[model samples]
Target: MSDLKLTRRQSLVLGAGALFALGTRGAFSQDATTLTFWSVRLNTPELQAALLPILAQFEAEHPGIKVVNEPVSGNLVYPKFLTAVQGQLMPDVAEAYSYHPLQFAALGQMAEMDDLIKSWETSGRLKDVVNEFAYKKFFWNDHYWGVPYNLDPRAIYYRKDLLEAKGIKPPTNWDEFQAAAIALNDPANGVYGLSFPAGNFHITQHFFMGFMFQAGGSILDKDGNLVFGTTARDANIRALTYLTDFATKHKVTPEGIGSWDTPDAHTFFQQGRAAFGMGTGVLIGEIQRGNPDLIDKIGILETLQGPAAKLTAGFFNPMFVWNYSPAKEAAMTFVDWFTQPGRLEPLYAANPGGLWPIFKSEFDSELTRSQPLMQEMLAKVIPYTTDFAYPGTGVPEMGVIDGEKMFAAPVNEVVIGQKTPAQAIDDAQAKMAALWEE
Candidate 1:
């Protein structure tokens, strides 16, 4: 056997070649139905243990169908799947970001799940399972090209003890948030008010979007035109100014905040170096595991309200069937079954907080009610959650703009004081507008 190497955005496993091999053999075996599934997060022993049994159950129910499950790294899954599409070796079902399926749908490479979902016995309950914003995120062009699988929403994680001691309340709005941050800063005490990720490519964009949305600004308008420079320019500047000021002006954040990413902020919070951090539910798990003492001290809140709205920037992972797959029906069958409340419960159990349920019923279930953090998230954050791509008006190019740091560069300039918020927003607007042309 020759060692096969696959490379594009990132060098993922050569294991994809094994899928190709199995695919070639399955082509010859006409009696059996083989469905190839490319997914991520199953590389761990824990995830594998949880997922393998589900695959077995699916195969047991449908004896003729064989699922060839392959795990890809998170960073490489999208690029590798793109490579598969280009090579005409796309999997029957693949895990993708909310934007990935949209991009693939635009290319006519993804199978629409609207009919399958409509026909499924549980389809009527989908809206109850998946939230409205998520439904809108996955539904585009009058069809659903993907099924909502996992949701991750941003929230403000604060130190309860720090706030109580300072006589500060959890901030409900932007003004209060800034005041609280400033009040909690104690440099000599070796504690900062907030730890933000201004240096991270994706996190910076997310933070900007959250603030922008709160300020009644959107990246794209109803007409699907870029609004950052025209109608939303001032709001964008306001958002940028507010975020950059935490580090540059107010100095409430750590001195190195300009270089911190999600993990860095997580570390800062876990070590009790910061009073507040912005992140998803993963922070709760990190606190539980690394700083057990702070479990009760830590409290989660919805993102701060801007002048125009209260919103939280979020991301969702979806699974989609390929238009080219020979096992489309079988693949859809598996997806339908996999999304069932019973089947999804174990998966959520395997990675609590890290993967939130997309279904409303799941949120109301005993399983979800047991996790107070998730319950609070369901009540407080998920209602206002919006994706970075700008739900309803998201364009495939926006993904490229986000991935290439087109938006992050200008935000970075503002954070470093190299440019004014107005100037940085102008630069980002110009850059993003140019992306549409390309």
Candidate 2:
């Protein structure tokens, strides 16, 4: 593996270099056609047990092809991939964040998948495909570059037992959510209303974007222009004010949230220190590992409504074949096989509430039916889910905007009282615009 530590300037330089790298002609194993795959699932016994067997089956069915699953952490996927690109050591296939394929595609490092998808549609296999939002995440520059692996929507997870004890129903909209958090918040007893990151991390950006969308504001309009501080200024201001109020005015979240990231928020929630936590189904798996007893007491809510709209950021972390792969057809075959319901169900069951199905019909599968909680979550989240490129198809600059912490900085400023929401938004807009102007 390549060294994971690289500066943002280095990453950009490597990204530009990827456009010139030639393809590797053969598999890492000379004896067989092996597909080197990078998976986002952590390298754990349970995940391996669920994933390896499916690869074995694919190998058995194909007779001459082998699939290797290399587990990588979610945060490191993009950087490691960029390193691979710079070295011309790209994997045959890899899973990445929802925004990454577009970046890779724009750099000419990712293979276009339109033909393979068309083949599936022609063969009537497209019915099992994920919904439009998931598919659209990888669609940019008039081509499809990735396949949706799972649906990652920003849903709320609350302490069911705690809410019940307080005689509160699960909140559905922003007002109800804030009220519930305030009413149940007891800082003296080490219980707060909400647990979410406000740090200079992508998790913070995700949360901030969700609120902005819920308030009917978008980062870019349909023409791919920055609008947060222009056309959608008021909605973004409202969104920022509400988000910071949790830490400043409402005083419901834990102290020093501006310094907290995903792990901090996860630990705070797992210890039963908060009444509400915001994340994807991944939170369920985290709680199950850190505090199994809390599992039965947890309730997942749909993306809450705001004054302007009912919307949340949906992440369709997709799998894409590197353009440098010699065996493109073989890689797609494995990609298609691994995403089938039968193969996906075992992985889902093994993780137990961690992975949500990208295919809409899988919600009614026996696996989902057996787990009542998953069924409830999918039903609610699907309706409110929108891609990070809301109100537009998607743009390559969107990845840069997210990677550079352009959105989180503004929210951090407002929360820390260094600037008003309007000032923060304006400064962020100026900084972001300056990036593309170069």
Candidate 3:
């Protein structure tokens, strides 16, 4: 009360007499048990409707802690994240898109979770938890940064009837894939072998990385150096080659397809003009609502393999902590409770659709014969699945420039015949060197 305030060193969430005077930007910790959270994802009604109650329940149970869900999405959040960190005003817990944490990790803004994970590991709870994707992505460099909360795999959706009618089996290799694409493509008849969203980096980056990995290439090696060389470089070339052939060479995907993003692919598939589309496995439910009859005719396959095809990435809204957060321990306890398998089981069921779960424990023996379609995905008739993680560009601005403009666009340009693979690489290489290098 006498100009004395709480410090995180003493306890999380200063209370009672503790107070904060905003706008002056002085460091002051409260002694209360309240936690502040921020996220880049717009505070959509759906998310609020789903999660607010969870927070309320948590708070109700822990009378000592008060949880506040701050709306920081849209223009309010992304820019503020950097500012807040500088001001030491970051939230106790926040929601962030797939790779957003990576930027925070680089800045040392994220709190470490080694102790939480170690505890969870020894506890039977971690063993019962099934989401391995979340587990793997949480650990960055050498420590835990974020916890994957909700992630869905990207699966190729094709018109099974079209493929079967044309005697085209799903292509296994790049050559076969292109040939089949050529066969199913009838652009003149308003049918695209495949359709793509042009500007959305999330989708485009995922697809390109898929090809790169299948070709046995990686965006970065273990040391974080960009993977480049004949194996890696040619893998990039191969990805560009097939991508371009769809519209540029074979003329299957419409030139218009390149202008639209994933939603475009969704529309194309729904309208039946595109024979193949890549989208979130969760989209299967939406598909059922529109094309109710063709539901069974839709073919689902694990993301196509690269030379290292089984390696793919999944995007997630991860739970992150702020370094300056005074209530990290309480926040982490909530994270642990939220991701617990029993908790996740209901979350998974809330959306009954095609998405494959990220946790191994999420799927149990009871699900073996849950349903035919789910069975196929679980059986993974193809015998392999790949996963993706945070790309180097985790910040919003960096994703737009480095991943979208610098990485994916050039490769797309080659696919569209605007640049030769070599030229495309040179262009991308120059941009990447200039940007990523110190």
Could you report the Cα RMSD, in angstroms, for every candidate shown? 5.2, 4.0, 7.1
In candidate 3, what are the lDDT values of residues 291-352, reduced to their tens digit?
Answer: 67877787766456455555554555577776656576778877777666545443344444
Q: For every model shown, what is its TM-score relative to the native structure?
A: 0.89, 0.89, 0.80
Residue 375 error, candidate 2, Å: 2.8
lDDT of 1 by residue, 360-427 (tens): 66677675677666677778788788776563445555556666666677677877778888888887
* lDDT tens digits by residue: candidate 2, 1-438: 222343343245234422334556337455678888887753567887888887788899998788877888766766787677666778898776666777767666688999877876797657766567577666777888887777766677788989999999999898999899999999898899998888888778888888999898988887667787899889998999898899889889888988888788878887889999876566766765677777688878867888888888867678889876887878888888777655677788777666777776677877677665676677777667777777876667777787778899987887778888889989998876754553
Cα miss at 284, model 3 (Å)?
Answer: 1.7
Error of 2 at 267 (Å): 2.5
Q: What local distance difference test score does each model get? A: 0.73, 0.77, 0.59
lDDT, model 1, position 317 = 70
Model 2 clashing residue pairs (backbone): none
Better of 1 and 2 by lDDT: 2
Full candidate order by lDDT, most accurate first: 2, 1, 3
Q: Worst 10-residue stretch by lDDT in candidate 2?
A: 1-10
